[model samples]
Structure formats: structure tokens, C-alpha cells
Target: MIRLHHCHETRSMRSLWLLNELDLEFELQIHPFDKSLRSPEYLSLNPAGRVPALEIEGDVVFESGAITELLCERHSPDRLGRNPQDPDRPDWLTWVHFAETVSQHSAALTQQHIALYDDAMRSPIVMKLEAARLGKCFEAIEGRLSTPVENRDYLLTSGFSAADISVGQAVYMARHFVRLEAFPELAKWYDRITERPSFAASLPPEGAELLYKRDFYEVWNG
Candidate 1:
């Protein structure tokens, strides 16, 4: 069975969501971010000491995007993995990579500079720079969603795919760094993604204590 080592309120949620979308049964190993990640035993599982590590057939895989790809390849090949004979295979692969490349930067920057900084009060200039950078990244996503889609409601060629799962989580995180109302198109997309049964089902129970307690404003208001 696939085993997921997860921490609440992190990109690990993406892995959980992917498994749910794939309709695969797996064991969930809940671990506290502050403790388990640094423990000697856990370090043996992942040198980076990050949450959302996957153990499959005795092999460990870390990184949320990679984990999602692995699950799709193993259990939901028809939905996410490519068919070599399909002409759209290249586009599908591009969509998968684009999610992390374009959407993850802003959220990562905000978390590192504003949310997690040790001396946030002492670095007003850096904070402003980070905010500006985040804004620019959000604008890029807005432009993409606003572009005319041929027929699909998602970022991919047809139906939802791993690209939506990856990029959707990034956009969800973006709420921490920018106001969703400011980006109408992206906000629309966010609402649509959240409404999906797969996405909603992946969320942890409400009020469940999270590993990193973030302010509500950071989560919804951005």
C-alpha cells in the first residue's frame, strides 16, 4: 500500500488531494511538522526533512509535485499520465511543469520573507520587494486564465488533470500574499477548483489543528 507522511496545512495537502482524485486507497501517517521532520528516524526517510513524503514499495519520494506525478502514474494513468501516441502529450507535460514553475514562486517568496522571517519588523524594504514580486506573479496567472480557453474549464486540454491540482494549490496559497479580489480571473478559477468534489474532499476536517498555525487573513484574504 502507498503510505503518505503528511503534515497539516502544507503542500502535503496536494498529495492527499491527488490520491483522493485518483480514487486510490492509501495509508496516511500524520506527523507533526516541528517534531517528526527533524527526528533521526524521519531524516532517514527524507534528507530534506519536509512533510508529505511518500513511501511506496520501500522507496521514499519527497516534494509534493513529484509525489503527485508518481501517484498519477501509478494509479490514475488515464487521467494524468500521458499516452505516447497522443499528439497532446507534450502539451500535457508542459501544463504539469508550468503549475510549479509559474505559480509556486510567489507563495514561496511570501512564506519565506513575510510569514516565516525571524525579524520581519527589521526588513521593511525586503518585505515590500517580496510583496511586489508576489503581485507580479499573481498577475501572470490572471492573464493566463483570462486568455480564451478552447473548451475546457481547466488549464489542460480537456477535463481536470494534475496540472489543475498542482496550480490550484499554488493559487490557493496565493491568498496569503495577495487579495484574491484583485485578480478576478484567477479568483474565478480558484472558486471553480475549490468547488470540485475531489478538491473539497481532500481538505482536512475543519478546526483540525495544523502544524503551522497561520492567521485566517493569510489564508483567505491573501
Candidate 2:
């Protein structure tokens, strides 16, 4: 049996989307995104105490990127993943992992804007810095989408794959901190990928606890 440990709108959403796209039958164990993650029970699944601890065939996997690679390798190698022999393999790996690059900034901004309970506990400088970094990541994606390649609708030339899912989810989180209006290509790509049924299914269910309560968190200048 395959079971996915998830928290609404967290990095784990990437794995959730992939599972939906692959049409895999797996049970989802939702956890509150708080100190509970560090509880011994959850830690047993992911020693790192993070979201997206997948149990498959009695073995567990942690880290969103690692899980994405393994799932695609085992279930959808040709479509969601590229074999080492495939020319797009390197690019695929790059884009797939780059999701973390985008998420790190979002994680920091999340802490600054939402996790901290008081204004004094939050750092305006850190908020602005992290949000700016997210913009830089958006610029990188814009460059990729704007590449002169014949059809750059997705990250990989071959077609839509786990790379888009990974980065798309990261963008989903990052958008709460940084707007996508400036990057037209990135915005269009995001809209296109998010329209997929799998992506839609990955969204947090109605009345579910959400890590991001607001649609947008403006960067503080103070």
C-alpha cells in the first residue's frame, strides 16, 4: 500500500500532485503544519520532521525532490521522468530540483509574514529580502519559458512532466509572498499547469486547515 503524509499547501503538495497525475491509489495522512510535525510519530516516518513522507512497499521516502524522482522513475519514467539516456535528463533534473530553490525563499517569507505571531518578532528586512529573492527565481523561470525553443509551454522540451509539477507547486507557495504579474511568461505557464485536473485535486480540501490564510502577503518595508 502507498500512503502519503501531507500538510495543506506545503512542499508535500508536489508529491500529492504527482500521485494524482500518475493516477496512483494511495492513502493520504494529513497532518497539522506545526510542532506536531516534530512529534515522535511523524518523525518515525521522516526523521527530518517534514511533510511528504511516503510509505511504499513497507519503505518510506522523505524530501519532496527525492520522492518526485523515485515516483516518476517507478511509475511514469517516460512521461513524468526522463531516463539517464534521454537528452532532457539533465535539464529535467535541474528544473525538478529547482523547485526547492523557489521554495526556500517562500519558506522564509512564510515564517516572517505568518509564523511569527507579533510584529516585533518579524523582520521587515528579512521579509523584503526573501520576497526579492523569490522575484529573482521568477526571473529565472521567465527566462526558461521565454527560451527560443520551438514550444516552451513546460519546463522540459519533451513535454509536461514532474518538473512542472514540482516547480508549479513551489510557485503556488511562492505566489503567496511574491506576485507573478511581472513575469508574463511565468504567469501564463503557471495558469496553464495549474488548470490540470491533477493540480486541481492537489488543492487543500474545503474547511481544511491552511498554512497560508491570505491570498497575498505584501512585503513589509519597515
Candidate 3:
């Protein structure tokens, strides 16, 4: 049996979207995004108390990148994941993990804007800095999508894959802090990939408590 511990709008959504794409039969256990993740039971699965803790085939995978690799290795070594032998493997791995680079900035911005409740606790400097970093990430994706290729639809020349899902979900979170209007290529690619049914399935169900209450967070000057 496969089970995924998820929290709405968290990085876990990446796994959820991939699972949906893979058409895998898995149970999803939704958790609130809060200190409750530090509970002993949750910690037993992922010592880091993260949102995504997958239980599969009597083994557990904690990290989102690891889970993406393991799931693709076991289930989709060709389609969603490029095996080591595949020519696109290097670019695939590079783009897949690059999602975290985008996510780290979003996480910091989230903390500065959402996590810290008090105005005194929030850092305008940090928010602006991280948001700028997210824009840089967007620029990288724009450059990739604009690369000289027959059809620059997805991140890889090989076409759609988990790499898009990985970076796509990270963008989903990062978008709350950084607007996409400046990066036309990135915006177009994001719109294209997220149109998949799998992406829609991973969205928070109606009435679910959303991690991001606002569609965009305006960063104030320090």
C-alpha cells in the first residue's frame, strides 16, 4: 500500500501531483500546516517534521526530491522520470532539483509575510530580497523555456515530465510572493503545465484551509 502525508499548498503537493500523473493508487493523509507536524508520530516518519512523508512498500520516504526520485524509479523510469541511461537524465535531474532552489526563497518569503504575525516580527528587507531571488529563479526558467529548440513547451527537450511538476509546484507557492507578469516565458510555461488534470487534482479541495490565503503578497519597502 502507498500512502502520502500531505498538507494543502505545501511542497507535498508536488508528490500529490506526480502520483496523480502516474495514476497510482495511493492514500493521501492531509495534515494541517502547523506545529502539529512536530508530533511524535509524524516525527517518527520524517525526523525533520516536514509536510511530505510517504509510506510505501513498508518503507518511508521523507524528502520531496527523494520521494520524486524513488517513485519515478520504481514506477516510471521512462515517462515521468528519465533513467540514468536516458540522454535527458542530466538536464532532467538539474531541472527537477532546481525546484528546491525556487522553493527555499518562497519559504523564506512565506515566513516573513505569513508565518510572522506581528508587524514588528516581519522583515521588509528579507521579503524584498527573497522575492527578488524568486524573480531570478523565474528568469532562469524563462531562459530555459526560451532555449533554441524545436518546441520549447516544457523544461526538457524530451517533453513533459516530473521535472515540470517539481518546478511547477514550487512556482505555485512562490507565485504568492512574486508575480509572473514580468516573466512571459515562465508564465506561459506555468500556465501550460498546470493545465494538466494532475495539477488540478493536487489543488486544495473546496473549503480546505489554504496555506496561502491571498493570491499575492505585496512586499513593502523596508
Kindly list the per-residue Cα lDDT of model 3 for residues 32-78, writing each as its tens digit. 99999999999999999997999999999988999999999999999
State TM-scores per candidate. 0.83, 0.98, 0.98
Q: What's the true lDDT of residue 162 in model 3?
A: 94
RMSD of each: 3.5, 0.8, 0.8
lDDT of 2 by residue, 1-222 (tens): 999999999999999999999999999999988899999988999999989899999899998999999999999999999999999999999999999999999999988988888888888888888988999999999999999999889999999999999999999999998899999999999999999999989999999888888999997765
- C-alpha lDDT score of every prediction, in listed order: 0.70, 0.94, 0.93
Q: In candidate 2, what residue range of length 10 has the lowest lDDT sum?
A: 213-222
Better of 1 and 3 by lDDT: 3
Mind giving the per-residue lDDT tens digits that candidate 1 earns over 1-222? 789888766777778778877877789998865755888888888888877789988889987767866777777666766665666567667766665654455545555544564653334555456566667767877776777867646665666677778777766665665677888887887888889787887776798775334532232122
**Residue 50 error, candidate 2, Å:** 1.4
**Candidate 1 segments exceeding 4 Å error:** 102-122, 211-222
Ranking by TM-score: 3, 2, 1
Error of 2 at 142 (Å): 0.2
